[model samples]
Target chain A: MTKTELFNQIKTKKSYLCVGLDTDIKKIPKHLLSSEDPVFEFNKAIIDATSDLCVSYKPNIAFYEAMGPKGWQSLAKTLEYIPKDCFSIADAKRGDIGNTSSLYARAFFDKSASGMSFDSITVAPYMGKDSVSPFLEFENKWVILLALTSNEGGKDFQNLELAEGTEVYKKVLEVSKNWGDSERLMYVVGATRAEKLREIRAIVPDSFLLVPGVGAQGGSLFEVSKYGMNATCGLLVNSSRGIIYASSGEDFAEKAREEAQKIQTEMAEYLDQFLK
Target chain B: MTKTELFNQIKTKKSYLCVGLDTDIKKIPKHLLSSEDPVFEFNKAIIDATSDLCVSYKPNIAFYEAMGPKGWQSLAKTLEYIPKDCFSIADAKRGDIGNTSSLYARAFFDKSASGMSFDSITVAPYMGKDSVSPFLEFENKWVILLALTSNEGGKDFQNLELAEGTEVYKKVLEVSKNWGDSERLMYVVGATRAEKLREIRAIVPDSFLLVPGVGAQGGSLFEVSKYGMNATCGLLVNSSRGIIYASSGEDFAEKAREEAQKIQTEMAEYLDQFLK
Candidate 1:
């Protein structure tokens, strides 16, 4: 999906929410185990329940991969199930050398090759330009490069100052911005570092930011929207555990909708407060 | 495989060569298309032909993933077929948050969870300690961190100097060395940057270095061995296309063996010249 299309979806929904599908087999309701593909069944329910409450769905690829071939099958099915109106993110965190990365781009963007194609795939920037440029070659497909991540270890290297007097993550932002425009490229900035959003927005004011670390990770949606929102409302604040696993009972899907509704309502208020 | 066992294999074979199975379906010989699983059939023949000539097999995960679930099945069979004496590497280059990284660890390290177990897996260090530490928790499994990559884009951010006066990749080596001992940790210092090996050696002198970019990528065996080799012959120089795609016809396996033999012969000389 194009950046304008993504923003239109946000405006229509009155939410910049990107629900994360970090589904764990061990954590899901035991009753779903009777099904042939429990992971897919669970995701189907979650997507059905909350599709209208969010503008995008980010499936953490590791969760499906941990289950082996069957996991991949479930992942393929889930990708197919996500509504075309809602943007899809593979969240695969894949990047390699020029040739190898082209194959990765094919895997995620060319559904004919990999049985699944996402609107965007998260990529690591450690390998730099060539590793990331391959994904950008597929017109309209997005590359969400990792910036300031939410995890505790995120500070280990990302926060270190470069000799030119900028942090590593800042340098990553400055250098990588030229690789693709706001139309084709986005950044992953953790919501836990909400204060940094103001500084980050200054660097790439128009580019979208995929913000994880809300709710369960203790990032306030209000603060994130205040500092991160752009004229086009270029912010995709993601919530996984806080919404999907809200209830483990048979009403799991229903309860998930409730949690998503709570976030969407708040997001609507923020859209009015910030964008109006 | 343990570090001592890996070194012993190098001593026994007199070769630190790592044969990379970057098997692309389009690149393999047409005759293999008749098989139920052409990718697996190709890998099986290559493993049988070159297992003796190399001490390790690093399967580039992107190629397998491009084919989807079937590709993963081929990968599982290929991993199981590799000889017991040879070390195995899943060149997946995967790393995520703490919990997500644990799932990635299970995907590569636990046979029961992911249907394929590798002795080591390549990891990207951009996310820092937590993203990498989960993989280290697995006993006897290895984490070969991407230090100085062989690609042209490796210089993009890795060569950036920190405010503290050290390069980013050098700081990665210094800080991450404490994450795991040499027994369970390794670094990927590309043969393309053979000169940097000497400086990298000063930081983590005893840890094994998985060096790619030999042959097809224009890296020299003699140069890498001279600067990178240690008391244990601590280097696994990888050659993917140079050996595996040496011949694209019926004699492909035999030609692969011949190419691997050529590298093995040179590695033997390096072992003698450097270690003796």
Candidate 2:
């Protein structure tokens, strides 16, 4: 998916929230345990409940992967359940050698190969050109490279200043831009790093950003939107536990919708402000 | 598995080859499509043929995730078929917020929760402490962090010289050591960067190194072994396509075994030298 298409969705839906499907089987309602694939059942419910409120749905690969085969089934099913207009992301932070990355691109973007095609996939930029170029090779598909993350250790390296007077994360954003244009490339700048969003925006003003660490992680939507947003409202603020596992009881899906609604409501206001 | 356990297995098998099960459905033998799960069937045959010759199996999650739910099942089954003595890695490069990462840890390390318990997972270290800590919470499990990768773009930011008199990747290795002991953590130093491996060893001498790019990516196992090996033979050199997709025909599995044997024979020599 291109940044322009993502922007159009943001404007049309009036929401920037990317509901994170970090589904955990243990955290799902007890009733789902008996289903053939409880994780998928939970994901389907969450998608059905919150689809209208969010512009995108990001199913983190780790949550699905933990379940072994069942988790993968859940992820595929979850993608199928997600509204096609709502951007889908395989939150699989994959980056490797060029040839290997090409296969990974085929796996995620080529429906014939993997049967699960996501709009985008989270990629780690540490591997450089050969690792990232393969993901960008797919036409119109997006590559969300890791920038300044929301975690505490993000300070360990990302925030470190180089002799060139730029931070490591900033350099990652700058150099990775050469691989693909803003249309096919996005960045994962953690929502918790809201303060850095301003600096990040200056680096890649036209690119869309898959921002995690909102909601349950204490990253403020208002702060991120105000500082990071571009003319097109280029952000997909993700909320995983806050939306998917909002309630562990039978009303979990309802609770998830309610949580997602609250975020979307706020996102609508952000879009309105940006449009103005 | 602990570093000692991994080291002992490498010594006993006389191989440092960590055959990467980056199994793609498109790349698997056509005959396997007749099976209930082609990816799993291929992985089973590959493991059956190569188990004695190699000491580790690393399954890149993207190949399994691409197939959706069915692919994951194949991965779980593949993990099950791999010999218990051989270390199994999820190769799921996952890192997120603390609570979310906790769930990820539960998903990968807690077999009761996911059915596929991998000994280690590759992690993108950009998120900082909270993102990485949750993975470390699981006892005896490991977090193989992206340090200096083998890809061409690795020099983009990882090799950038910081004001602190160290390169960005060198600093990542230095700071992340405090997060966990060598037993619980390893660094991914690409085999293509063999010359720099000596410098990396100086900083992280005891930590296990998950070295990719050794086979088809043109990284020499001989060069990597010379500079990257430690007292415990701390190297899990990976070769993905070169071994796993050695042939795309009926003899695919047999071909995989032959290709793996070639690397294993070379690795056996490396191990012999380590013992000397």
lDDT of 2 by residue, A1-276 (tens): 556667778888788889888777767889999988888888888888988788898888767666665566667777878888888898877777676788778778888767778889888777788888888778778888888777776777788988988888899888888888888888988844555777888889988888887877788888888888888787889888888877889999999989888888888887777642
Q: Which ten residues in a row have the lowest lDDT in candidate 2 chain A?
A: A65-74
List, residue by residue over B1-276, the lDDT tens digit for candidate 1: 899999999999989999999999999999999899999999999998999889999999999999898889999999999998999999999999999999999899888888988999999999999999999999999999999898989999999999999999999999999999999999998854455777898999999999999989998888889888899988999999999999999999999999999989988888989972
- Best-fitting candidate, scored by DockQ: 1
Q: What is the TM-score of each candidate against the true structure?
A: 0.99, 0.89
Clashing pairs in 2: A69-B72, A69-B73, A72-B69, A73-B69, A128-B153, A129-B153, A153-B128, A153-B129, A154-B127, A154-B128
* TM-score for candidate 2 (chain B): 0.96
**Model 1, position B79: C-alpha lDDT score:** 93
Model 1 quality (TM-score): 0.99
For candidate 2, lDDT tens digit of each residue in B1-276?
778888889888888788898887767788888988778888888889899988889998767766655666777788888888998887877776676677778777888877768888888776777788999988889998888887777777778899878888888899889999899999888844556877888899898889888878788888888787778888888988898888888888799899988988888888777643
lDDT, candidate 1, residue B1? 88
Strongest candidate by TM-score: 1
For candidate 2, give the DockQ: 0.58
Instruction: Provide a comma-separated list of chain B TM-scores, one per candidate.
Output: 0.98, 0.96
lDDT of each: 0.93, 0.81
